[model samples]
Target: MPLAALVLLLLTGTLVPINRKFRETPGGIPVFVASNGLHTDVVVPTQDARTGLDWRPLLTASGQPARPAAYPFVAFGWGNAGFYRSSRGGHTPGVGTTLRAALPSPTLLHVSWCAGPPQPGTRVAALRISAAQYEALAATIRASFQADSVGRFVPAVMLGYTAQDHFFEARGRYHVLRTCNDWTNRILRRAGLRAALKAPLAGSVLYQVQHVPKTRNH
Candidate 1:
């Protein structure tokens, strides 16, 4: 029965949308969804004051000093910590770790400081959503971070990293049925954007975002 359910999920997860409504935002806030072939990340402008996210603590918690100009945007990605951390530093995790991550396991939030927006033809989708939509997306991202009693982001020290990015403890568990792309899709949906209902692959999310009309009148 479990195998049958898993097959059903994988089959239904790839179903394409039909007659999906694509709305336009009047001078909406620009955001980007990027994919590195395997995983996806949502990038938002750091200078957006309305987000109410203090970069100081995030930067300090990252344990990597960064300049404002050097990182105009912050990219957030969520996934299983075991697979995510092992994939870092050109190290591949063992099959046991991968299997555990593919099942139910602890998750982590990966943050990367970006200099500019995602490049063209690089599996990146850009969207201009309303301020309300952006606010919802930002709130969803912020809520993913696990905070201490004082409300500071709690860093996950089990992972080793050499890049400007950092990882923090995140809410929920990661599994094959509910992967990082699903989290990204959920966030986009929260912002009133069209996305796959259950996208476990990065390509699935990008495919749905590509269907949006480039230009639409209010």
Candidate 2:
């Protein structure tokens, strides 16, 4: 089974759907790539198909009454701290912000909880991976966060951009030349899946996984 994780690249709104063979595996659990035109996130089940991992502990709201399992999927992405935090409330960063993000800035891990399975289209695609592969991918995502002595992920002081998303401190620097897609591609390759050799744009990642057959879970 698996648990999941992402980065923001404020590039163009191009969505490429090229068929890539190294993107998925047959008869494996389903994961998804969710995009908002410019940036992309890797979405996974709250608890994997085998129930081998319960992500609730990591994403639990400290004082909320609702359980973490309420979310069907969790989309993870990474981005510059300023770009992520300031880009909230439908606000676009200014040239100053973009320039700062272009530098070696602190990073944050973005997590969005989905109510259901993602619908595949130009903006979304399914990628099937074996249980072992799922675990490896999840492990890389989990490692991005800064855990507390209590062992839970430490969320930013600010509220999520929306009701269903939150930002947490992460362990990378966001370079203007390196898009979030590069980070995700590394995760895919780490899991023994095929990914673009150079994924510096959101389209680079989406293009590779677009043709993967939709799994039953999707």
Candidate 3:
């Protein structure tokens, strides 16, 4: 081969990847985003009245029949289980980053975005706790929020997953104010906890509000 041709061939081989990413729909979840050689899928567990275990097509907040959030968690689930990601075919995006329990009895799992870019003064924060620990955390949150009725629920637990990495960190680090809005936020603000962090975090925010009944029925 000519010298120039030989050099070009070597450069091409080095630049191109050996394998390309394909979409993966493990567990029957649908894929949402596909980019930079990555596949992501989000599944919200649902059950059919007759079938026992069936998947209801996921929908967006607007109720306009939209796909799940793409890439890094487009939205946060109320509890601690669901999130969205991009998809293409069968290959999923790499294990972006994840925060999970220490095994044997994992409680919570936090999937993460790439970590190199470094947010100004933040790092990914994931948490996992045992049943006891979760209960304890819930109680602490109720106390912190000064929830009207602590006994109404075993600490109305909710997970705040954010598409923006900063929001995720803030949710992990700040007080109830950072994690909640409206009445919940009002309760936290009145409790004297600031929203933005001034010092380091002592624990995660536990935001709870009384589920008062109005004239309308459930």
Candidate 4:
């Protein structure tokens, strides 16, 4: 395979959701269009039915549509980097300055992904959880774990196995975890959110350890 094609496949394949068909933006970037193919999957539309939270129709500063609905959590993993790259870089031309720049002023909550080591050149996928949904998810994590430490559970929840052949080929777990960390840190800084929210941050290293691959005991 050609080097550029190999790189593109690695970046997109690992990042794009596989259980559904994708629709590309005018910029030529592919997006997780809908939740299909996975027979028993849950489809949490970008527009929450009950609350009418339509994150799907969010528009960039330049008036370009930011298609958050294209990718659902059950299929596309929840890491911030993809969105950061897509919004900040010129990937979707005239989209916005960055995810932060495009957000409504006085932004209550924000998500971002930081470029790291390999840099991956440009980010490929992205999504945003509504304030209500973010709160609900945070509450669930707190209730289940008895702490509001979101950073801790991020890796295990977002990163996992995927059937792709590229940089993400056999690299889903670590890649996801790494992307999650990059995102968590960036958002915390951008929103001026404390490392520990509502409770003293605890068990951080243990949280990072979630990336360790498991093995059968001898």
Candidate 5:
């Protein structure tokens, strides 16, 4: 049955990762995976130490209440465009909007700034990866952005949930299979980090990080 197949897939996805040997290199770039109970985001610095990929140029901070660029950490999240833009956690989205997200739909990149690292708890986990790995991860995030004619990430018209954060057009489909957590896991895999093979849920990815090779050097 379809329900049985989906259950099996979720079980396999939760239990399996692309690489069991993925190790968190000693003295690697520090990053954190932040989850808001249901959704996940990859948190990095304004400028990566290895690649020097500055997001200051692309993100909007003009006429804002806070200076996002000055923040110590930046978090990147991807999800359904309409859901993300209109969502304030104030109320659940309408039936139509929720149904649309169940299908292949437009996605948006949610870029938010954090003053400090996410506390290592159930909702937040930290990882240390090599410079090469960090750069690769950053590259993947960059590629996820929907580029313009000149290959630039345009800021979405909708105002951000916070003064320091803003939304931008992103390339991907937000559906049952390709959820926000799945995108985060894919980025980790591309960067050679410990990531679930199919992480459609935030808990799936968070649980796998606990099994990654840890180093005291971090």
Candidate 6:
């Protein structure tokens, strides 16, 4: 019975479009969703002068320098900490680690410095949303960061690095029902953009974003 139910959930989640309206934000802020085949990230401007979200503090806390002038965008992603911290040295986690992550485990927040907006391709999708939507999304992302009493982001033990990317402690639990892709989808929804209701896989989330018109007008 459990196996059957699991299969049903996957089937339904994979086939259905969570939000098919393709609604456009009225004068929305431009944001980008980036994917590297297996994982996805939400990219936003480093400092929204209007919203007053200076991401420099978060970057500094993670031991990353402030965003360079050429790279004005910051990318954020959430995932199981064990999978992220242990999947180093080209070593895949065993069944134990995988099961722990699949059943509500601690999570990590990944922040990266981006050169600019995501380009339309199999690996990236872009969307433009209103300032209101952007604020809500920013709040949601901010709430995910685990901070100290002084409100500085708590850096996670070093797992690995990729160019100008770093990871930090993140709030919330990660499970099969709320994977990294699901996190991205939720952030997009907070920004009033169309996204899959339950995107367990990166491809599932990217598939929905890919269908939307890539032009900024939308």
Number of the top-ranking candidate, with lDDT as the measure: 5
Could you give candidate 3's per-residue lDDT for residues 1-218 as a string of tens digits? Answer: 68787456433432332112211212322111111111111112232232232221221221223333233223111111111221213333344312211112111212233222212111222222223322332233333321233222121232223332211111222222121222222222232322111101112111111111112211
Question: Each candidate's lDDT (Cα)?
Answer: 0.78, 0.72, 0.23, 0.25, 0.82, 0.79
**What is the overall TM-score of model 3 with all chains considered together?**
0.18
Cα-based TM-score, every candidate: 0.87, 0.82, 0.18, 0.21, 0.91, 0.85
Could you tell me how far off, in angstroms, the CA of residue 34 lies in candidate 2 after the best superposition?
1.1
- TM-score between model 5 and native: 0.91
Provide backbone clash counts, one per model. 0, 6, 11, 1, 0, 3
* Total backbone collisions, model 1: 0
| Tens digits of per-residue lDDT for model 1, 1-218 | 59998777755765665325856575676788899888899998876765565465565654545556677788899998888878877777789887887778899998887878887565999888777888888889888989888777888885436565778889989988789998998888777787876688898888888777887642
The number of the candidate with the highest TM-score is 5
Score residue 71 of candidate 4 by CA lDDT: 39
For lDDT, candidate 1 versus 3, the one ahead is: 1
Better of 4 and 6 by lDDT: 6
Tell me the spans in candidate 6 whose CA falls farther than 4 Å from its real position.
25-27, 61-64, 89-96, 213-218
| Model 1, runs deviating above 4 Å | 16-19, 49-66, 158-160, 216-218
Q: In candidate 4, which residue pairs get closer than 3 Å at backbone N, Cα or C atoms, i.e. clash?
A: 32-70
**Residue 74 of model 5, lDDT score:** 88
lDDT at position 156, candidate 4 = 22
Off by over 4 Å in 2: 1-23, 49-51, 61-68, 211-218
Ordering by lDDT: 5, 6, 1, 2, 4, 3
Off by over 4 Å in 5: 60-69
Q: Compose the digit string of candidate 2's lDDT tens values, residues 89-167.
A: 7888788988887678888888888888799888887777878889998999999888878667878776777778777
Q: Ten consecutive residues with minimal summed lDDT in candidate 5?
A: 60-69
